[model samples]
Target: GEEVAQTPKHLVRGEGQKAKLYCAPIKGHSYVFWYQQVLKNEFKFLISFQNENVFDETGMPKERFSAKCLPNSPCSLEIQATKLEDSAVYFCASSHELPNQPQHFGDGTRLSIL
Candidate 1:
């Protein structure tokens, strides 16, 4: 079976500081996705990558967030200049891009900006 794992189930950071989250997607999956769920609301797509190349990042905030998908290494999402509104659960998912292939998600890294 395949799985996605994320570290630091919860994180607290002050405004203007930085927070980094990590994720390990299932092996053999080429597409990695990152999403944010704010206040238990909708899951907003932040970015997606295919084999280290960004496939879509139109939904990502241009100011404070960035992500990377690397081979063998766990994917990472880093937020700089954190703001209170930046708090949310950051989820990492992976899929094979095949029909009926659902994306597998991690428990997520909950971030709190104060």
Candidate 2:
């Protein structure tokens, strides 16, 4: 079984600062996903990648959120000019490229904006 991993378990940023997150997808997995949870019941899919190419990004905000799943490096998600509304728990997940395969998730990084 492949396991996803995330760095910086906790992040704190002042308003207008930048916030960056790192994710390591499970070995052998071809699909990578990022999600944001602002409220307990609200989990928003942010982006996904197939190998090093972006596959889907239906939920990512064009201006403030950006992500990369580059080969030979940890996948990264960044938010520029952070605002209080950006505070949330960011999750990284990975799965096989095959359709319907379950995604494995890492413990999220909690981002706090002040």
Candidate 3:
């Protein structure tokens, strides 16, 4: 099956350090989303991008979290000055439609703040 690819399955960083995660959405998908999972089965939408422009980022933390999706390149999510609360698994999902459409998620990158 075609799948989204996430790099560095696990990452560790000290408090106040920075963490960057990469996601390669499945080919042909036109929309990409970023999520943060803090508790099991609990996911918080962080941001989303349609092609190279951001679609929705209402859930993003204005200060420390940033994401970008550029043509012909993998999408990226970055966390600056990471805090203990930032420890979570970041997942990227892709879809062809905005709503009522099936989305595929990447393996997820687990970030641990120490």
Candidate 4:
């Protein structure tokens, strides 16, 4: 498919709940991007991967937040023991490693933590 496929448009979890979001990047695209958005503001890049390996994770939270890109599987961002501050729209973009390929994005998963 040409577009990134994200599942469950909206998710609600209570404090200390475990919330998992899924993103299937455009097929054959080797690079995937992840970000967290709050109040329609700037995107904060969380992590990115090429194929199944981590390329950069400097922006990712040190704890309670985890993500994975696995072979033959959709990429995922899982929030463990979610906090009220964890609420946000998590977006993922994908493209080839080349400099000019336009990145494709998924309609972010809105995670609401109460």
lDDT of 3 by residue, 54-85 (tens): 99999999899999999999999999999999
Tens digits of per-residue lDDT for model 2, 14-96: 99999999999889999999999999879999999999999999999989899998889999999999999999999999997
Q: What do the candidate models score in CA lDDT, each in turn?
A: 0.89, 0.93, 0.93, 0.91
Cα displacement (angstroms), candidate 1, residue 44, comes to 0.6
Task: List where candidate 4 sits over 4 angstroms from the true fold.
Answer: none
Off by over 4 Å in 2: none
Pairs with steric clashes in candidate 3: none
Candidate 4's displacement at residue 38, Å, is: 0.9
Put down candidate 1 lDDT per residue, 7-110, tens digits, no spaces. Answer: 98999999999999998888888888999999677899999998788989999999888998877788899999999999999999999875578999989999
* Model 2: how far residue 29 lies from native, Å: 0.4
lDDT of 4 at 93: 95
